[model samples]
Target: MHPPDAPGTEPCDWSWETAADPDEVHALLTACDAHQATASGTPAPRRRPETTRWLVESGSVHLLRHTTGPAGMFTLTARPPSGTDESVFPPAEHPLYLSRLAVAPAWLAGGALVGLRCVRQAVETAAGLGGDTLRAQVNPDLRDTCSLLDLLGFTPCGPASADETGRRHAHLHRPLTAPAADRRGD
Candidate 1:
Protein backbone atom coordinates (compact mmCIF):
# COMPACT_ATOMS: atom_id res chain seq x y z
CA MET A 1 0.00 0.00 0.00
CA HIS A 2 1.21 3.52 -0.76
CA PRO A 3 1.11 6.40 1.73
CA PRO A 4 -0.87 9.61 1.33
CA ASP A 5 0.14 11.06 -2.00
CA ALA A 6 -0.36 14.64 -0.85
CA PRO A 7 2.55 16.39 0.78
CA GLY A 8 1.53 17.31 4.32
CA THR A 9 2.28 16.79 8.02
CA GLU A 10 -0.47 14.28 8.49
CA PRO A 11 0.42 10.63 8.92
CA CYS A 12 1.49 9.33 5.54
CA ASP A 13 -1.90 8.11 4.39
CA TRP A 14 -1.72 4.52 5.56
CA SER A 15 -2.52 1.65 3.17
CA TRP A 16 -1.17 -1.76 2.24
CA GLU A 17 1.56 -2.38 -0.34
CA THR A 18 4.16 -4.94 -1.35
CA ALA A 19 7.24 -4.80 -3.57
CA ALA A 20 9.70 -7.37 -5.02
CA ASP A 21 7.39 -10.26 -4.15
CA PRO A 22 9.28 -11.18 -1.00
CA ASP A 23 6.79 -13.96 -0.16
CA GLU A 24 6.09 -12.30 3.22
CA VAL A 25 4.58 -9.05 4.41
CA HIS A 26 7.00 -6.16 5.09
CA ALA A 27 6.58 -3.21 7.44
CA LEU A 28 8.75 -0.42 8.80
CA LEU A 29 9.26 -1.92 12.24
CA THR A 30 12.68 -0.34 12.63
CA ALA A 31 11.09 3.05 13.06
CA CYS A 32 9.27 1.78 16.10
CA ASP A 33 12.64 0.89 17.48
CA ALA A 34 12.61 4.23 19.19
CA HIS A 35 9.37 3.40 20.93
CA GLN A 36 10.79 0.08 21.99
CA ALA A 37 14.02 1.74 23.06
CA THR A 38 12.28 4.24 25.27
CA ALA A 39 10.21 1.51 26.87
CA SER A 40 12.96 -1.04 27.25
CA GLY A 41 15.89 1.37 27.06
CA THR A 42 17.66 -1.29 25.09
CA PRO A 43 17.69 -2.37 21.46
CA ALA A 44 17.27 -6.09 21.69
CA PRO A 45 15.55 -6.69 18.37
CA ARG A 46 18.40 -5.90 16.05
CA ARG A 47 17.50 -5.44 12.40
CA ARG A 48 19.28 -7.96 10.26
CA PRO A 49 20.58 -6.75 6.90
CA GLU A 50 18.53 -9.42 5.18
CA THR A 51 15.40 -8.95 7.27
CA THR A 52 13.31 -7.95 4.26
CA ARG A 53 14.02 -11.28 2.70
CA TRP A 54 13.08 -13.11 5.88
CA LEU A 55 9.96 -10.99 6.34
CA VAL A 56 8.90 -11.73 2.78
CA GLU A 57 9.62 -15.41 2.95
CA SER A 58 7.82 -16.30 6.17
CA GLY A 59 4.81 -14.00 6.55
CA SER A 60 1.85 -12.40 4.80
CA VAL A 61 3.22 -8.87 5.11
CA HIS A 62 1.44 -5.64 4.08
CA LEU A 63 3.37 -2.44 3.52
CA LEU A 64 2.14 1.13 4.14
CA ARG A 65 4.20 3.80 2.43
CA HIS A 66 3.69 7.55 2.31
CA THR A 67 2.02 7.83 -1.06
CA THR A 68 3.98 8.12 -4.33
CA GLY A 69 5.88 11.22 -3.27
CA PRO A 70 9.11 12.21 -1.54
CA ALA A 71 12.30 10.26 -0.98
CA GLY A 72 12.22 9.54 2.78
CA MET A 73 9.44 7.03 2.31
CA PHE A 74 8.40 4.90 5.28
CA THR A 75 6.33 1.71 5.04
CA LEU A 76 4.79 -0.49 7.69
CA THR A 77 3.65 -4.04 7.10
CA ALA A 78 2.12 -6.77 9.28
CA ARG A 79 2.96 -10.40 8.94
CA PRO A 80 1.38 -13.57 10.23
CA PRO A 81 3.20 -15.57 12.85
CA SER A 82 5.08 -18.70 12.01
CA GLY A 83 3.23 -21.98 12.56
CA THR A 84 0.05 -19.92 12.87
CA ASP A 85 -2.02 -23.08 12.30
CA GLU A 86 -3.02 -23.93 15.86
CA SER A 87 -6.10 -21.77 15.40
CA VAL A 88 -5.15 -19.03 17.85
CA PHE A 89 -7.91 -17.13 16.12
CA PRO A 90 -11.09 -18.24 14.43
CA PRO A 91 -10.78 -18.54 10.67
CA ALA A 92 -14.04 -16.74 9.98
CA GLU A 93 -13.91 -14.44 12.99
CA HIS A 94 -10.25 -13.49 13.45
CA PRO A 95 -8.54 -14.30 10.20
CA LEU A 96 -5.67 -11.91 10.74
CA TYR A 97 -4.01 -10.82 13.92
CA LEU A 98 -2.40 -7.36 14.00
CA SER A 99 1.08 -8.66 14.49
CA ARG A 100 2.84 -5.29 14.28
CA LEU A 101 2.12 -1.55 13.90
CA ALA A 102 4.81 1.05 13.29
CA VAL A 103 5.23 4.57 11.95
CA ALA A 104 8.17 6.81 11.16
CA PRO A 105 8.94 9.74 13.47
CA ALA A 106 8.03 12.27 10.81
CA TRP A 107 4.67 10.63 10.11
CA LEU A 108 3.44 10.50 13.71
CA ALA A 109 2.22 14.08 13.53
CA GLY A 110 -1.37 13.06 14.23
CA GLY A 111 -0.24 11.24 17.35
CA ALA A 112 -2.46 8.42 18.50
CA LEU A 113 -5.27 9.58 16.28
CA VAL A 114 -3.33 8.44 13.26
CA GLY A 115 -2.74 5.09 14.88
CA LEU A 116 -6.45 4.53 15.53
CA ARG A 117 -7.20 5.39 11.96
CA CYS A 118 -4.66 2.87 10.78
CA VAL A 119 -6.22 0.23 13.01
CA ARG A 120 -9.65 0.99 11.61
CA GLN A 121 -8.40 0.65 8.08
CA ALA A 122 -6.61 -2.60 8.83
CA VAL A 123 -9.68 -4.05 10.56
CA GLU A 124 -11.91 -3.10 7.68
CA THR A 125 -9.45 -4.57 5.21
CA ALA A 126 -9.20 -7.77 7.23
CA ALA A 127 -12.97 -7.99 7.48
CA GLY A 128 -13.20 -7.69 3.74
CA LEU A 129 -10.87 -10.67 3.70
CA GLY A 130 -13.30 -12.54 6.01
CA GLY A 131 -12.19 -11.61 9.51
CA ASP A 132 -14.25 -10.44 12.45
CA THR A 133 -11.89 -9.48 15.26
CA LEU A 134 -8.42 -7.92 15.38
CA ARG A 135 -6.36 -9.10 18.28
CA ALA A 136 -3.14 -7.58 19.58
CA GLN A 137 -1.10 -7.32 22.75
CA VAL A 138 0.45 -4.28 24.33
CA ASN A 139 2.87 -3.94 27.17
CA PRO A 140 0.88 -3.12 30.30
CA ASP A 141 3.56 -0.94 31.82
CA LEU A 142 3.41 1.46 28.92
CA ARG A 143 0.86 3.82 30.40
CA ASP A 144 0.81 5.83 27.20
CA THR A 145 -0.40 2.75 25.31
CA CYS A 146 -3.33 1.86 27.57
CA SER A 147 -5.23 5.01 26.73
CA LEU A 148 -4.62 4.44 23.03
CA LEU A 149 -5.95 0.91 23.38
CA ASP A 150 -8.95 2.15 25.33
CA LEU A 151 -9.54 4.81 22.72
CA LEU A 152 -9.39 2.08 20.10
CA GLY A 153 -12.09 -0.02 21.86
CA PHE A 154 -9.84 -2.58 23.48
CA THR A 155 -10.65 -3.82 26.96
CA PRO A 156 -8.16 -5.57 29.06
CA CYS A 157 -8.57 -9.34 29.40
CA GLY A 158 -7.88 -8.80 33.11
CA PRO A 159 -4.55 -9.22 34.85
CA ALA A 160 -4.83 -12.89 35.73
CA SER A 161 -5.59 -14.10 32.24
CA ALA A 162 -2.85 -12.00 30.63
CA ASP A 163 0.10 -12.71 32.89
CA GLU A 164 1.99 -14.88 30.49
CA THR A 165 4.61 -12.26 29.64
CA GLY A 166 5.90 -11.50 33.08
CA ARG A 167 2.55 -9.86 33.77
CA ARG A 168 3.60 -7.00 31.54
CA HIS A 169 1.02 -7.29 28.74
CA ALA A 170 -2.75 -7.10 28.54
CA HIS A 171 -4.60 -8.89 25.84
CA LEU A 172 -6.60 -6.45 23.72
CA HIS A 173 -9.36 -7.08 21.20
CA ARG A 174 -11.08 -5.00 18.56
CA PRO A 175 -14.15 -5.93 16.59
CA LEU A 176 -14.87 -5.02 13.00
CA THR A 177 -18.51 -4.18 13.72
CA ALA A 178 -17.54 -1.13 15.78
CA PRO A 179 -17.80 1.93 13.60
CA ALA A 180 -14.35 3.37 13.02
CA ALA A 181 -15.69 6.75 14.08
CA ASP A 182 -16.96 5.30 17.33
CA ARG A 183 -13.70 3.58 18.09
CA ARG A 184 -12.80 6.55 20.20
CA GLY A 185 -14.40 7.40 23.60
CA ASP A 186 -15.06 3.74 24.21
Candidate 2:
Protein backbone atom coordinates (compact mmCIF):
# COMPACT_ATOMS: atom_id res chain seq x y z
CA MET A 1 0.00 0.00 0.00
CA HIS A 2 1.13 3.54 -0.67
CA PRO A 3 1.44 6.32 1.86
CA PRO A 4 -0.81 9.34 1.86
CA ASP A 5 0.18 11.81 -0.81
CA ALA A 6 -0.77 14.79 1.30
CA PRO A 7 2.23 16.37 2.89
CA GLY A 8 2.51 16.32 6.70
CA THR A 9 0.27 13.27 6.99
CA GLU A 10 1.52 10.11 8.60
CA PRO A 11 2.49 7.25 6.32
CA CYS A 12 -0.17 4.53 6.07
CA ASP A 13 0.28 0.77 6.12
CA TRP A 14 -1.92 -2.07 4.82
CA SER A 15 -2.25 -5.62 6.08
CA TRP A 16 -3.98 -8.56 4.43
CA GLU A 17 -5.34 -11.22 6.75
CA THR A 18 -7.61 -14.19 6.31
CA ALA A 19 -9.28 -13.56 9.63
CA ALA A 20 -10.07 -10.33 11.48
CA ASP A 21 -11.19 -9.98 15.09
CA PRO A 22 -14.99 -9.96 15.15
CA ASP A 23 -15.17 -7.23 17.74
CA GLU A 24 -12.96 -4.92 15.70
CA VAL A 25 -15.04 -5.57 12.63
CA HIS A 26 -18.21 -4.87 14.54
CA ALA A 27 -16.84 -1.58 15.83
CA LEU A 28 -15.92 -0.51 12.34
CA LEU A 29 -19.32 -1.48 11.02
CA THR A 30 -21.03 0.48 13.75
CA ALA A 31 -18.99 3.53 12.95
CA CYS A 32 -19.84 3.16 9.30
CA ASP A 33 -23.54 2.80 10.05
CA ALA A 34 -23.49 5.94 12.10
CA HIS A 35 -21.76 7.82 9.34
CA GLN A 36 -24.25 6.59 6.78
CA ALA A 37 -27.16 7.55 8.95
CA THR A 38 -25.82 11.04 9.39
CA ALA A 39 -25.05 11.50 5.73
CA SER A 40 -28.25 9.99 4.33
CA GLY A 41 -30.62 10.67 7.19
CA THR A 42 -31.62 7.00 7.28
CA PRO A 43 -30.01 4.65 9.69
CA ALA A 44 -28.46 1.61 8.16
CA PRO A 45 -29.51 -1.74 9.55
CA ARG A 46 -26.92 -3.08 11.95
CA ARG A 47 -25.28 -6.26 10.78
CA ARG A 48 -25.74 -9.29 12.97
CA PRO A 49 -22.87 -10.89 14.86
CA GLU A 50 -23.08 -13.99 12.72
CA THR A 51 -22.89 -11.88 9.58
CA THR A 52 -19.76 -10.20 10.89
CA ARG A 53 -18.20 -13.57 11.62
CA TRP A 54 -19.14 -14.78 8.16
CA LEU A 55 -17.32 -11.83 6.62
CA VAL A 56 -14.15 -12.58 8.57
CA GLU A 57 -14.21 -16.23 7.60
CA SER A 58 -15.48 -15.86 4.04
CA GLY A 59 -12.57 -14.04 2.45
CA SER A 60 -9.34 -12.12 2.86
CA VAL A 61 -9.84 -8.89 4.74
CA HIS A 62 -7.55 -5.96 4.08
CA LEU A 63 -6.98 -3.34 6.74
CA LEU A 64 -5.42 0.07 6.32
CA ARG A 65 -3.76 1.72 9.26
CA HIS A 66 -2.34 5.16 9.58
CA THR A 67 0.06 6.22 12.32
CA THR A 68 -3.01 7.17 14.31
CA GLY A 69 -4.86 3.87 13.92
CA PRO A 70 -7.12 1.70 11.73
CA ALA A 71 -8.32 3.85 8.82
CA GLY A 72 -10.36 1.45 6.71
CA MET A 73 -11.20 -2.16 5.90
CA PHE A 74 -12.50 -4.25 2.96
CA THR A 75 -12.91 -7.89 2.04
CA LEU A 76 -12.40 -9.66 -1.29
CA THR A 77 -13.89 -13.03 -2.07
CA ALA A 78 -13.78 -15.00 -5.29
CA ARG A 79 -17.18 -16.22 -6.42
CA PRO A 80 -17.77 -19.00 -8.90
CA PRO A 81 -19.81 -18.19 -12.00
CA SER A 82 -21.91 -21.34 -11.77
CA GLY A 83 -24.62 -20.25 -9.34
CA THR A 84 -24.49 -16.52 -9.96
CA ASP A 85 -27.28 -15.00 -12.01
CA GLU A 86 -26.08 -13.80 -15.41
CA SER A 87 -28.30 -10.73 -15.18
CA VAL A 88 -26.55 -9.38 -12.14
CA PHE A 89 -23.01 -10.48 -12.87
CA PRO A 90 -22.62 -11.15 -16.54
CA PRO A 91 -19.64 -13.25 -17.49
CA ALA A 92 -18.96 -13.76 -13.81
CA GLU A 93 -16.32 -16.44 -14.38
CA HIS A 94 -14.84 -16.48 -10.87
CA PRO A 95 -14.87 -12.76 -10.35
CA LEU A 96 -13.45 -11.19 -7.21
CA TYR A 97 -16.30 -9.70 -5.20
CA LEU A 98 -15.55 -6.71 -3.02
CA SER A 99 -17.59 -6.33 0.15
CA ARG A 100 -17.83 -4.66 3.57
CA LEU A 101 -15.74 -1.71 2.44
CA ALA A 102 -15.68 0.92 5.13
CA VAL A 103 -13.56 3.95 5.80
CA ALA A 104 -13.77 5.27 9.35
CA PRO A 105 -15.92 8.36 9.59
CA ALA A 106 -12.84 10.33 10.57
CA TRP A 107 -11.00 9.30 7.42
CA LEU A 108 -14.09 9.75 5.26
CA ALA A 109 -14.63 13.31 6.50
CA GLY A 110 -11.11 14.16 5.38
CA GLY A 111 -11.54 13.12 1.73
CA ALA A 112 -11.96 10.29 -0.74
CA LEU A 113 -8.27 9.41 -0.67
CA VAL A 114 -8.74 6.62 1.84
CA GLY A 115 -11.63 5.15 -0.07
CA LEU A 116 -9.81 5.45 -3.38
CA ARG A 117 -6.78 3.64 -2.01
CA CYS A 118 -8.93 0.83 -0.67
CA VAL A 119 -10.68 0.31 -4.01
CA ARG A 120 -7.39 0.49 -5.86
CA GLN A 121 -6.05 -2.19 -3.58
CA ALA A 122 -9.04 -4.33 -4.46
CA VAL A 123 -8.35 -3.92 -8.17
CA GLU A 124 -4.69 -4.84 -7.77
CA THR A 125 -5.50 -7.82 -5.58
CA ALA A 126 -8.07 -9.06 -8.06
CA ALA A 127 -5.56 -8.88 -10.89
CA GLY A 128 -2.95 -10.68 -8.84
CA LEU A 129 -5.42 -13.46 -8.12
CA GLY A 130 -6.03 -13.98 -11.85
CA GLY A 131 -9.51 -12.61 -11.61
CA ASP A 132 -11.06 -11.39 -14.82
CA THR A 133 -13.22 -8.83 -13.09
CA LEU A 134 -13.98 -7.15 -9.79
CA ARG A 135 -17.63 -6.91 -8.82
CA ALA A 136 -19.65 -5.28 -6.07
CA GLN A 137 -23.29 -4.89 -5.15
CA VAL A 138 -23.67 -1.47 -3.57
CA ASN A 139 -26.63 0.12 -1.89
CA PRO A 140 -27.90 2.68 -4.35
CA ASP A 141 -28.61 5.12 -1.57
CA LEU A 142 -24.92 5.23 -0.74
CA ARG A 143 -24.15 7.71 -3.47
CA ASP A 144 -20.57 8.19 -2.35
CA THR A 145 -19.76 4.52 -2.81
CA CYS A 146 -21.46 4.37 -6.20
CA SER A 147 -19.52 7.44 -7.25
CA LEU A 148 -16.27 5.93 -6.06
CA LEU A 149 -16.93 2.82 -8.11
CA ASP A 150 -17.62 5.02 -11.12
CA LEU A 151 -14.38 6.92 -10.60
CA LEU A 152 -12.53 3.63 -10.46
CA GLY A 153 -13.98 2.45 -13.80
CA PHE A 154 -16.78 0.21 -12.61
CA THR A 155 -19.89 0.12 -14.78
CA PRO A 156 -23.41 -0.85 -13.91
CA CYS A 157 -24.25 -4.34 -15.08
CA GLY A 158 -27.91 -4.36 -14.13
CA PRO A 159 -30.71 -2.24 -12.81
CA ALA A 160 -31.06 -1.59 -9.11
CA SER A 161 -32.98 -4.32 -7.32
CA ALA A 162 -34.46 -4.65 -3.88
CA ASP A 163 -33.43 -7.41 -1.51
CA GLU A 164 -35.69 -9.34 0.83
CA THR A 165 -35.39 -6.61 3.41
CA GLY A 166 -36.27 -3.94 0.82
CA ARG A 167 -32.71 -2.64 0.61
CA ARG A 168 -31.82 -1.77 -2.96
CA HIS A 169 -28.52 -2.67 -4.59
CA ALA A 170 -26.90 -1.67 -7.84
CA HIS A 171 -24.66 -4.22 -9.47
CA LEU A 172 -21.38 -3.01 -10.87
CA HIS A 173 -18.29 -4.59 -12.41
CA ARG A 174 -14.83 -3.57 -13.63
CA PRO A 175 -12.68 -5.67 -15.86
CA LEU A 176 -9.33 -6.23 -14.20
CA THR A 177 -7.41 -6.78 -17.41
CA ALA A 178 -8.38 -3.47 -18.97
CA PRO A 179 -5.53 -1.35 -20.18
CA ALA A 180 -4.30 1.42 -17.92
CA ALA A 181 -5.44 4.03 -20.41
CA ASP A 182 -8.89 2.51 -20.45
CA ARG A 183 -9.06 2.84 -16.70
CA ARG A 184 -8.37 6.58 -17.04
CA GLY A 185 -4.76 5.96 -16.01
CA ASP A 186 -5.71 5.45 -12.39
Candidate 3:
Protein backbone atom coordinates (compact mmCIF):
# COMPACT_ATOMS: atom_id res chain seq x y z
CA MET A 1 0.00 0.00 0.00
CA HIS A 2 1.15 3.53 -0.69
CA PRO A 3 2.04 5.78 2.23
CA PRO A 4 0.51 8.84 0.60
CA ASP A 5 2.29 11.21 2.95
CA ALA A 6 5.68 9.64 3.23
CA PRO A 7 8.67 11.60 2.08
CA GLY A 8 10.43 10.77 -1.17
CA THR A 9 11.56 7.18 -1.49
CA GLU A 10 10.16 6.11 1.86
CA PRO A 11 8.85 2.58 1.59
CA CYS A 12 5.38 1.97 2.97
CA ASP A 13 4.55 -1.69 2.89
CA TRP A 14 1.26 -1.95 4.69
CA SER A 15 -0.84 -5.08 4.60
CA TRP A 16 -4.35 -6.36 5.32
CA GLU A 17 -5.08 -9.58 7.20
CA THR A 18 -8.26 -11.34 8.23
CA ALA A 19 -8.24 -12.38 11.86
CA ALA A 20 -9.61 -15.93 11.93
CA ASP A 21 -9.69 -16.60 15.65
CA PRO A 22 -12.02 -14.97 18.16
CA ASP A 23 -9.26 -14.50 20.73
CA GLU A 24 -7.01 -12.85 18.15
CA VAL A 25 -9.77 -10.54 16.98
CA HIS A 26 -10.56 -9.52 20.54
CA ALA A 27 -6.93 -8.64 21.20
CA LEU A 28 -6.87 -6.55 18.04
CA LEU A 29 -9.98 -4.64 19.09
CA THR A 30 -8.58 -4.05 22.57
CA ALA A 31 -5.30 -2.73 21.25
CA CYS A 32 -7.02 -0.51 18.70
CA ASP A 33 -9.38 0.94 21.31
CA ALA A 34 -6.46 1.59 23.65
CA HIS A 35 -4.53 3.31 20.90
CA GLN A 36 -7.46 5.47 19.87
CA ALA A 37 -8.23 6.47 23.45
CA THR A 38 -4.62 7.44 24.06
CA ALA A 39 -4.29 9.28 20.79
CA SER A 40 -7.58 11.15 20.99
CA GLY A 41 -7.42 11.76 24.77
CA THR A 42 -10.96 10.40 25.09
CA PRO A 43 -11.39 7.04 26.66
CA ALA A 44 -13.42 4.94 24.23
CA PRO A 45 -16.44 3.40 25.85
CA ARG A 46 -15.59 -0.24 26.31
CA ARG A 47 -17.47 -2.63 24.02
CA ARG A 48 -18.60 -6.03 25.19
CA PRO A 49 -16.01 -8.72 24.47
CA GLU A 50 -18.83 -10.90 23.22
CA THR A 51 -19.74 -8.30 20.67
CA THR A 52 -16.20 -8.28 19.35
CA ARG A 53 -16.28 -12.04 19.20
CA TRP A 54 -19.57 -12.00 17.37
CA LEU A 55 -18.13 -9.70 14.73
CA VAL A 56 -15.24 -12.07 14.24
CA GLU A 57 -17.59 -15.00 14.06
CA SER A 58 -19.56 -13.17 11.43
CA GLY A 59 -16.35 -12.99 9.35
CA SER A 60 -16.25 -9.22 9.36
CA VAL A 61 -13.12 -8.54 11.41
CA HIS A 62 -10.28 -7.45 9.13
CA LEU A 63 -6.98 -6.04 10.31
CA LEU A 64 -4.70 -3.45 8.78
CA ARG A 65 -1.11 -3.30 9.89
CA HIS A 66 2.13 -1.69 8.88
CA THR A 67 5.34 -3.63 8.56
CA THR A 68 5.97 -2.78 12.19
CA GLY A 69 2.60 -3.61 13.71
CA PRO A 70 -1.12 -2.95 13.78
CA ALA A 71 -2.01 0.32 12.07
CA GLY A 72 -5.77 0.24 11.51
CA MET A 73 -8.87 -1.93 11.18
CA PHE A 74 -12.52 -1.88 10.07
CA THR A 75 -15.60 -4.10 9.96
CA LEU A 76 -18.36 -4.01 7.37
CA THR A 77 -21.99 -5.14 7.21
CA ALA A 78 -24.60 -5.16 4.47
CA ARG A 79 -27.50 -2.74 4.67
CA PRO A 80 -31.04 -3.46 3.56
CA PRO A 81 -31.98 -1.97 0.19
CA SER A 82 -34.78 0.01 1.78
CA GLY A 83 -32.40 1.09 4.55
CA THR A 84 -33.53 2.47 7.89
CA ASP A 85 -35.73 5.52 8.54
CA GLU A 86 -35.44 8.24 5.93
CA SER A 87 -34.50 10.71 8.66
CA VAL A 88 -31.43 8.61 9.21
CA PHE A 89 -30.25 7.12 5.89
CA PRO A 90 -31.04 7.19 2.20
CA PRO A 91 -32.23 4.25 0.13
CA ALA A 92 -29.92 2.09 -1.99
CA GLU A 93 -30.21 -1.36 -3.54
CA HIS A 94 -26.65 -2.34 -2.58
CA PRO A 95 -25.08 -0.69 0.41
CA LEU A 96 -22.42 -1.59 2.92
CA TYR A 97 -22.18 -0.09 6.35
CA LEU A 98 -18.73 0.68 7.61
CA SER A 99 -19.62 -0.58 11.03
CA ARG A 100 -16.29 0.28 12.62
CA LEU A 101 -12.97 1.84 11.62
CA ALA A 102 -9.96 2.96 13.63
CA VAL A 103 -6.43 3.94 12.74
CA ALA A 104 -3.57 4.12 15.19
CA PRO A 105 -1.98 7.54 15.63
CA ALA A 106 1.34 6.04 14.63
CA TRP A 107 -0.12 5.43 11.18
CA LEU A 108 -1.56 8.92 11.05
CA ALA A 109 1.93 10.18 11.80
CA GLY A 110 2.76 9.22 8.19
CA GLY A 111 0.28 11.82 7.05
CA ALA A 112 -3.44 12.29 6.39
CA LEU A 113 -2.68 10.36 3.24
CA VAL A 114 -2.22 7.23 5.29
CA GLY A 115 -5.64 7.60 6.81
CA LEU A 116 -7.12 8.38 3.40
CA ARG A 117 -5.63 5.26 1.92
CA CYS A 118 -7.08 3.14 4.68
CA VAL A 119 -10.55 4.58 4.24
CA ARG A 120 -10.30 4.19 0.48
CA GLN A 121 -9.55 0.56 1.12
CA ALA A 122 -12.83 0.34 2.97
CA VAL A 123 -14.67 1.88 0.05
CA GLU A 124 -13.02 -0.55 -2.31
CA THR A 125 -14.01 -3.42 -0.05
CA ALA A 126 -17.60 -2.27 -0.19
CA ALA A 127 -17.52 -2.12 -3.96
CA GLY A 128 -16.16 -5.64 -4.03
CA LEU A 129 -19.12 -6.74 -1.97
CA GLY A 130 -21.48 -5.48 -4.69
CA GLY A 131 -22.22 -2.32 -2.80
CA ASP A 132 -23.25 0.80 -4.67
CA THR A 133 -23.26 3.05 -1.63
CA LEU A 134 -21.09 3.12 1.46
CA ARG A 135 -22.50 4.35 4.75
CA ALA A 136 -20.99 5.37 8.05
CA GLN A 137 -22.04 6.95 11.34
CA VAL A 138 -19.49 9.41 12.66
CA ASN A 139 -19.50 10.93 16.09
CA PRO A 140 -19.07 14.67 15.67
CA ASP A 141 -16.64 14.68 18.56
CA LEU A 142 -14.26 12.55 16.51
CA ARG A 143 -12.94 15.31 14.32
CA ASP A 144 -10.17 13.25 12.79
CA THR A 145 -12.48 10.54 11.52
CA CYS A 146 -15.08 13.04 10.38
CA SER A 147 -12.46 14.96 8.46
CA LEU A 148 -11.12 11.87 6.82
CA LEU A 149 -14.56 10.76 5.69
CA ASP A 150 -15.36 14.19 4.30
CA LEU A 151 -12.08 14.39 2.46
CA LEU A 152 -12.71 11.04 0.82
CA GLY A 153 -16.03 11.98 -0.82
CA PHE A 154 -18.41 11.06 1.98
CA THR A 155 -21.13 13.64 2.51
CA PRO A 156 -23.17 14.28 5.64
CA CYS A 157 -26.69 12.96 5.11
CA GLY A 158 -28.50 14.23 8.18
CA PRO A 159 -28.26 15.99 11.50
CA ALA A 160 -26.54 14.54 14.51
CA SER A 161 -28.34 12.35 17.04
CA ALA A 162 -27.52 10.17 20.00
CA ASP A 163 -26.54 6.56 19.35
CA GLU A 164 -27.14 3.68 21.75
CA THR A 165 -24.40 5.07 23.99
CA GLY A 166 -26.13 8.45 23.82
CA ARG A 167 -23.15 9.91 22.01
CA ARG A 168 -24.07 12.29 19.18
CA HIS A 169 -23.50 10.94 15.68
CA ALA A 170 -23.85 12.19 12.12
CA HIS A 171 -24.54 9.98 9.12
CA LEU A 172 -22.20 10.02 6.12
CA HIS A 173 -22.65 8.46 2.69
CA ARG A 174 -20.29 7.87 -0.25
CA PRO A 175 -20.91 6.47 -3.68
CA LEU A 176 -18.73 3.49 -4.48
CA THR A 177 -17.96 4.51 -8.04
CA ALA A 178 -18.30 7.54 -10.25
CA PRO A 179 -20.64 7.28 -13.23
CA ALA A 180 -18.92 5.84 -16.28
CA ALA A 181 -19.35 9.04 -18.27
CA ASP A 182 -17.96 11.10 -15.42
CA ARG A 183 -14.82 9.02 -15.37
CA ARG A 184 -13.64 10.60 -18.60
CA GLY A 185 -13.99 14.12 -17.15
CA ASP A 186 -17.38 14.71 -18.68
Q: Rate the local accuracy (lDDT) of all candidates.
A: 0.49, 0.74, 0.69
Model 3, 1-186: lDDT tens per residue? 335345553344567777566665666567656766666665565667887787778877677766666667777877422223345666677778885676655555555455566688888888998888898876677788888899898998878776465556678889887766899998
* TM-score between model 3 and native: 0.75
TM-score of each: 0.57, 0.80, 0.75
After superposing all C-alphas onto the true structure, candidate 2 shows an RMSD in angstroms of 5.0
How large is the C-alpha RMSD of every model relative to the true structure?
A: 7.4, 5.0, 4.4
Q: Output the better candidate (2/3) by TM-score.
A: 2
Candidate 2 lDDT over 19-94, as tens digits, reads: 4687777788679878976787654765787777776776577776666657777878875222234567667565
Which candidate achieves the best lDDT against the true structure? 2
Candidate 2 residue pairs in backbone clash: none
Q: Which lDDT tens digits does candidate 1 get at residues 1-186?
A: 223434463553444554344322223455554655566554324445366565545443455544432112222234343322323333333435664555554545334244555565666666776655666655555565567668867665444233323434455666666555677855
Best by TM-score: 2
Worst 10 residues of 3 by lDDT: 79-88
> What lDDT is reached at residue 44 by model 2?
76
